[model samples]
Target chain A: MSRQDAPPIYLDHAATTPVDPEVFATMKPYFTEHYGNPASIHTVGQKAIIAVDEAREQVADFLGCKTGEIIFTSGATESNNFVLKGVLAAAKIQKPHIITSTIEHPCILDTCQHLEKRGVEVTYLPVDKEGVLNTKSVQEAIKENTVLVTIIYANNEIGTIQPIAEIGEIIKKANQERKNKIIFHTDAVQAIQYLDCNVKKLGVDLLSLSGHKFYGPKGVGVLFVKEGTLIEKIQHGGHQEYNKRAGTLNVPGIVGLGKATELTSKNRVADSKKQQKLRDLLINSILKNIPDSHLNGSNKHRLPNNANIRFDKIEGESIMLHLDFEGIAVSTGSACTSGTLEPSHVLLAIGVAKEQAHGSIRFTLGKDTSEADIKKVLEVLPPIVKKLRQMSPLK
Target chain B: MDHFRDPHNMGSIKDPDGVGEVGNPSCGDIMKLYIKVGKNEAGKEKISDISFETMGCAAAIATSSMITDMALGKTLAEAIEITNQNIAEKLDGLPPTKMHCSNLAADALKKAIADYKSKNK
Candidate 1:
């Protein structure tokens, strides 16, 4: 029987998509057959270097940037920290002012918040009720000391796609008046499939991507450091990543990320259309079956693969656990804070009531997700919600 | 099904004066224990009955069943010591993660029994 006919349907792609079979096939040879370190000067090492560069070139082509721009790191979290710390060390940016949104991934939001504790000034811009981020508000939040404006390309919890291109332009216009040009950065951990990520076109100076967010292996990510951008070294070890990122290379993971990026570039348009259709199917059925259900983010200005819903008078973890028992995987909000009972900050940022935020669930579709799987989820979920509510205090 | 559905004595307690309520909002599980205790016509205290209402997984429901059965007729002191480890050991051991819920539920029951003892004294 085909694996597609299996019972448990995975709906939590945002948490982590299964490694694509295509990516695995491409990465398999590197672990054993060509295990030499890329940094060594020997011929075997030179061969590994060529393989790494080829993958880098593939990622660069996919991102529409120079091959020299992509710096491999552990994941998006490190990339984000690198960018934030890098600005602090730059010769031009002294006691830098950083601007970020309140609803960014914890890696971005927490990093910026922590930086504030160390005497670095930070302004957290607000989003609209639909979790909508506006460039105008971000522009207004910038100050004379503003050093870097980093925003998430898409929110992992609510799936709201920020206006990154517009914000990029705002930074560009502002740079003309200031001698110290403000660097633009984005945590595109959730935008691998949808965002129009032409670094030159988007006018961004730095970008962060995690392999696990796409259908690749974990523990590997890419940071697009625009050539000549003034960012400091966060880690001081070997001369890896052109002295930008330190430590030994994760060769297999880097290869997988490159293949995954190549696959995304090739199939994003078709895959997004497929996921959008499946997302709507599940969403429409859920709204019809569950009472007091509402979309958490903008219906149109969100990830095509993501459907976040708030079901009043119910708990998200209960729903997730019940769904998990039924062989369907899902999420309450960001995986970063899914352990807590407190409402998601993203939901709260968008003006969702505290009770509604506790009831939210994020269902993210992926490359292999199908219409059949969506229909099966619709069949299994309503009764679980009804049964849980029937026994709950809010009922 | 709302009341622990103990096919043997589900919600059959008469005027359950002793009760317990403990819940975890994050995990979305709540267990409520109902116990009856009063002095007989001859002027001696006895636990007349016990029951429960729990909202959780099948394992949780089963755990609730085991708890009510264990608490039904015991002296307040004896019932108060019935712990999560006891419940798991009784039920052939719950999966590791569910062990926490079992402990929380047992603690709630013991606290209820203690509360009852305090009121009587």
Candidate 2:
């Protein structure tokens, strides 16, 4: 069939999800009818402030936290930066230390790298073969000057869910014996959709999540800061977000995020069950049909919707482009796709060879993904792999 | 893009007169060129057939296919003159990041010609 005649199948949900219609409808009125600065004292502004407060309450309810603890920012990138830099800046010691894993998103890793140049000591703990962090490593890395322990709840590329609650428990136990209590932060951008995010249960002092990853409008996110966790403001400006994040609020995006959070709280169980079934089917079928193909990351502890597979001898960009021609969208860890000279750091940290990392593809299912879509991918992918393998010289 | 979708002159030739392989898997691209050298009507050594086996991205595979098509049935002297710029131009253009792919393609062809000359000498 011609490319124009083929139906487009979207399976790259880990990158971003389309905004839910209900969330969009909830946000519509705030954009036009209730448009006002929340900082103003006029009635129009009060309307905006009420909406923002309601949104904050909704987010707090979803996370099982207090409304005052939730500080909204631009997105998870800002929220991550705020937690890392803010906490370090507020440290009382001459040389503060941080403990984080190697699989965090670039925002967190780059921020840590930048802080290292300015005299902050950072211990980058490595993960196991399945991209799972060892809590023992975290406990070993902490020192008298250690101020924060930030880790990703679920990895972006491999979708391996880390043991955040266990790590949090370890920190809590260690804090009881020290004069300086260590703060635990988690970048839960990918975990908000599938896993439990109760702040009390997870024992996290701070958590960051983005709206765009969970079918909400972009440019809005939340940073849950437990009361009494010392963190100075990163962006200095007028008093906003309890003087933690200083900027005029994005009211519409907040409303959308609130609606999205409410919907997720209601439908998470059913969504998880459905997507897990489809994800397993996709993984099993691909592994069975393709030769020399294997799954990356931990199969048992991964996100319900993510499947990262590597095919021997064939490059992932070629497979991805071939799939694109068939009107299917997926992602790859190959350096060619990322416009960089190195492959995925997450894969590398998990012990995947550089050449093998070049052959990995990521398929992330979403709410709208269907059995038909999975079938279409299964029907098209084997032949593409075969053709590319025939043309490859890696055998 | 068309060449990437339906690559031409793919696969290696059996018992070819010369072979040239370039690139490494560490850099995420490897191209091997196979050439068959024969005499033309003018009694000059010419490339009668050529094919490539490449393991890389769309740009890498597409450039490999394009170079094979450009060098086939050309005199040895003509084939040796195929520069990376000419190969990229023949494929319309390549992204700046993928220009190295075209360079690999041209280098593979030149190496094949050199291999042929060394054997004939």
Maximum-TM-score candidate: 2
Off by over 4 Å in 2: A5-7
Candidate 2 Cα deviation (angstroms), residue A21: 0.6
> Model 1: per-residue lDDT, tens digit, A20-137?
9999998898899888899989987877788889889988998899988999999999999989888877836457799988898888788787888888898889999888887788
RMSD per model, one decimal? 4.2, 1.4
Query: Each candidate's lDDT (Cα)?
Result: 0.80, 0.93
Q: What is candidate 1's local distance difference test score?
A: 0.80
Clashes of 2: 0
lDDT of 2 by residue, A352-377 (tens): 99888899999999988899999989
Candidate 1: residue pairs that collide: A86-A232
Please give the range of 10 consecutive residues that has the lowest summed lDDT in model 1 chain A: A333-342
Chain B structural similarity (TM-score) per candidate: 0.77, 0.97
Number of the top DockQ candidate: 2
